[model samples]
Target chain A: MTVKVQREDFDVGAELAAMTRGKTSIGGVTLFVGLVRDMAGGESVSAMTLEHYPGMTEKQLEAIEAEARARWPLDDALIIHRYGRLEPGDQIVLVATASAHREAAFESCHFLIDWLKTKAPFWKLEATPEGERWVEAKDSDDAAAARWANQDGDQKG
Target chain B: MKVLYFAWLRTKIGVAAETVDLPPEVKDVGGLVEWLKTRSPKHAEALANSKVVKVAVNQEHVPYDHPLSPGDEVALFPPVTGG
Candidate 1:
């Protein structure tokens, strides 16, 4: 497993290739990338800035990825998140998971993203036409992460 | 002890971080927030809506009742909105 927090953009293709170069047992790799949205809270966002508690951010992300590993039988996992100023359409985060089967890879990827959304220490500020405003955490997100609270063991794999 | 603010809280509070001596009466995160509000009007405005402000002790999310120590690091901010 790997976790990276960087300001520079990453080559997803190269990252995936390097991750699965010699892993013949891996049957599936699931990847998800988050981007800066132009529209947010019904306003037109011109630019955005991501802020994070540097030391805590990495620790939290590693913990989140570890949780996904514990829940699924996975071969490898990676999480990349960016910080600093970004324009619309900029890549913000990426999650890649590999497994012998697709179910574990898919579900674990989804779980990692969900947990990262609420558990991570990163915050966002969007430069809207009205002005800059801090993004609020949606209750729906907390509810989404809460679904795993009762999950005890591997039910889908 | 050190108190760090992030995002809008930093903007509202007009500072990123500050060092302060822990008061004897302040035993937990909630008490710290209450005492911090007295430091300035900006702090009061930023922390007025306690429901929206979140706190972390030593970089770990904790409830308001979480205990504090003399050398601990405390961060105040809004809920996380990232993926």
Candidate 2:
């Protein structure tokens, strides 16, 4: 498993190749990449700045990655989140999970992103036509994370 | 103790971090926040709504009733919105 918080962009192809280089047992890989949008809340967004709590951010991410591993029989997992100024269509984050079966890989990937949305300590501020505004936390995001709570029976190989 | 703020809380407070000597009565995160609000108007404005402001002690998320120590590191910020 790996977690990376950086300002530089990542190459999806290279990262995937490196992850599965010698892992012949892996049968499936699921990944998700978040991107900056040009429009938000009905306003035209020119740019976005991602702010994070540095030390605490890494610790929380590692904790959640560990949680994902405990609940899923997975071969590998990865989380890459970016920070700082970004324009529309810029990559913000990436989550990937690998397992012997497609079900485990797919479910774990969904769980990681759901948990990351609410538990991670990063914030986004968008520069709009009027001015910059901080993105508000959505209740829907919290609900998405909450659905996985108490789902102990969902754990599978 | 050291206190840190992030995002809008930092912007509203006009500072990112500060070192403060806690009062004897401040024994928990909630108490520390109440005391901090008394420090300045900006602090009061930033922390006016404690429900929206989340707190962490020593880089770990904790309840408002979580106990505090003299040398602890405290951070206050809003709910996370990342993916």
Candidate 3:
């Protein structure tokens, strides 16, 4: 597993290739890319500044990835999150997973992204015409993470 | 102790960072918040609704009962909204 927080842009194609390298057993690769949306929660977002607890952010992401690996037969996983100022059309995050079968790769990839959205430490300050405001946490994110909780499974420490 | 504020909490508090000496009895984040409330009316008002304020110790998300030390760094912010 690999987790990174950087200011430079990442190429999804390169990252996917890197994770799949030397893995002939892998039959499927799944990925999720999140971009800055122009609007959210009825507010128009012109730009966003992403802030995070520098040290803890990567730790939390590693924990989330470990949990995903424990629950699935994934061969490898990669997470890349960008910080600092970002405007619409800029990529915010990418989650990629590889596995022997499509099912495990797809499910675990989705799980990793969902869990990161809620559990990760990154915060966004949205620049709106009304004024700059912090984006509110969505109930959907909580609900997404809650689905994994119902399994009565332990998260990998 | 150095206190940092982020996200909406920074906006509401009107400052990004500050330094203050915490009382000895304030053993944890919860206690420190209570003491901060008495420092100024704005602090009291900003933290009045604890649901909106998330606390961190040394750049880690910590529980309210997390302990504090003299030189420890503490941060306060709103819940995350990143994807």
TM-score of chain A of each: 0.95, 0.96, 0.94
Model 2, range A1-157, lDDT digits (tens) per residue?
A: 9999999999999999988999999999999999999999999999999999999999989988999889899999999999999999999999999999999999999999998988889989899989999999998888778778747655321
Task: Please give, as one word, the docking class of candidate 3.
Answer: medium
lDDT of 1 at A20: 97
Best by TM-score: 2
Clashing pairs in 1: none
Off by more than 4 A, model 1: A153-157
What TM-score does model 3 achieve against the real structure? 0.89
lDDT accuracy of residue A110 in candidate 2: 93
The candidate 3 chain A region of ten consecutive residues with least summed lDDT is A148-157
i-RMSD values for every candidate model: 0.7, 0.7, 1.5
Point out where model 2 deviates above 4 Å: A153-157
Candidate numbers, best TM-score first, in rank order = 2, 1, 3
In terms of TM-score, how similar is model 2 to the real structure? 0.97
lDDT, candidate 3, residue A45? Answer: 91
Candidate 1 lDDT over A1-157, as tens digits, reads: 9999998988899999999999999999999999998998789999999999989899989988888898899999999999999999999999999999999999999889988998899999999989888899999998788776647543221
TM-score, model 1, chain B versus true chain B? 0.97
Error of 2 at B71 (Å): 1.6
**Which of the two candidates, 1 or 2, achieves a greater lDDT against the reference?**
2
Q: In terms of lDDT, which candidate is stronger, 1 or 3?
A: 1
Better of 2 and 3 by DockQ: 2
